[model samples]
Target: MNKAENIIVGISIGDLNGIGGEIVLKTFEDERILDFCTPVIFASIKSMSFLKTHFKSTINFHSINSINQVASGKVNVFNCWKEPVNIDFGKEDTKIGEFAIKSLASVTKALKNGDVDVLVTAPINKHNIQSEEFNFPGHTDYLAQELEGESLMFMVTDTLRVGLLTDHVPVKDISKHITSELIEKKINTVYNSLLKDFKIGRPKIAVLGINPHTGDSGVIGTEDDDVLRPTLKKIKDTGKLVYGPYAADSFFGSNNYKNFDAIIASYHDQGLIPFKTLSFGQGVNYTAGLNKVRTSPDHGTAYEIAGKGEADENSFKEALYTAIQIFKNRCDYEEITSNQLKKAPRIERKQRPN
Candidate 1:
């Protein structure tokens, strides 16, 4: 809603023991990035100071005790916790996970309350960040519950976009989850997301088959033949430019995905594997179809490279840019649609036989 440069980006410092801190600090290391958006990092000054010292970073931070104190054109560090936290790089500790939760919970509330215009999350350890207070599979699932509208894990780069039908489900249970109704829901979500979020008009979408070679035409499995085929037909009949049940194996291999605006994979690995293969270090994990905007880098905690000062900040920077752009796009979309509705010509009835 705010101007592009003035938009507030609420950030969550992810797992302390991982590369979350490193990447986040590195992304904003260039002060010019502040020209695009104001960033508020939800973590204590103490924790960030520790990361700064360990990484030997020279970047300065505008430390604040609350969100209201956040100022534009500087990296604002809000103290989610006042106390210091122990940081052992590459080690997985549940205690550190609690701090990650504090950062995430506070920023999420800020996003809900409109304290922040958009959210750009750092990578959290999916395992360690699990407890009674936060028990979702990942950020997408948690955000789906907190935010309005269904959520879809839409992995994206500038040229490529891939959405998963079943993000966190196990492979064995994937088929049962991919019903006719779900196909419609996920497809519609992606379709609308393209129109509103990505500014695509008359978007073309493609769906990858659930089974190999689309069940070998019912030889390997019949779910694709029975469920996906008919559901896709119904969607296509409704005047949507949706197509496929295309063989997942060759969709990306042959660069056939470039033909469509978006691609929907039946399950997680089916889509992510190729997406990462193509844009591993540059992709963003966008939570599309939600009222509030959120995005994260394609990479994870990267415990292997934690504390090494060797992490690349491209993906995190890309996520930040994507979140801001999407927020602006959504705002523009609402305004345009609302104005069209207001300006629409009214029809008046005439009495013929009076």
Candidate 2:
């Protein structure tokens, strides 16, 4: 395969002790995956080898010191750590957590340096991965801080796309954060993402309400009516096809979301609950509005099923494909728009014919 044609996918080995390594091994086990993009795993070669041996995986990968050594049609791994730490599968070890951060930081550097076209992150344990160097709730915030922009935690699939107003925040604090300004910001992010990343020219967006039954005409809660409604109106006034304060409970049941290009939830569970319910094993968690492309499986570190060879790789694989597709879509959009600008309008010459 020509290096020029391959999309280099940078993968961060999420928790070394979790199913991150197992799923990565399974995803690349089939060589056909290399047909679309080249995969670069940012982790210790030692740890990967240990997992491969334990899992009895037939997957073959090349270890490299830098992404510049990546080869098309091959699974290339950039060694983030040299030390051979004990492979404690399904256990929460602090050392493993530290290396996970190292791997993420390493691949993130490559993403910033333009060495990789996109990133597909494995799941990480939020608690264990916490440290002085990595102090975020999850991948969304960490990437948002590193990439610098409005980061909307977007869960997507072939069937549905859902975005969150607040990610990894506590339930009690959710309402305080659901202000008009915040709603406007996140809704705008979702709209732009649909247009650029998903390539929807005029995305029809549905914004979910914060309270049950959309505040029941202000009896249940007033945020939906006072905050979300006014904010959505402002968004629609700007010529965007945005609507909402829709009741989250009935939105999915009524199949109303089918009419919209994307749905925005006022909180984490509000949007993701329905999305994960419908597309749990196939959903891709895409971080939209970032400076670069980043995606991950909707599931987390399944410690109970980590080393059992029972962890499904469908979601992880979808994440990889989604990142590549979004990158391609953005490129195609830029070309289409740029070419349209280059094409001048036709000039009329009627009198000259006589």
TM-score of each: 0.97, 0.94
For candidate 1, what is the TM-score? Answer: 0.97
Scanning candidate 1 in windows of ten residues, the lowest lDDT window is 1-10
- What is the C-alpha local distance difference test score of candidate 1? 0.93
Model 1 CA lDDT for position 175: 97
**Which residue pairs in candidate 2 have backbone atoms (N, alpha carbon, C) closer than 3 angstroms, thus clashing?**
none
Instruction: Single out the weakest 10-residue window by summed lDDT for candidate 2.
Output: 1-10
* Residue 255 of model 2, lDDT score: 94
**Tens digits of per-residue lDDT for model 1 on 181-259?**
9999999999999999999999999999999999998899999989999999999999999999999988998999999
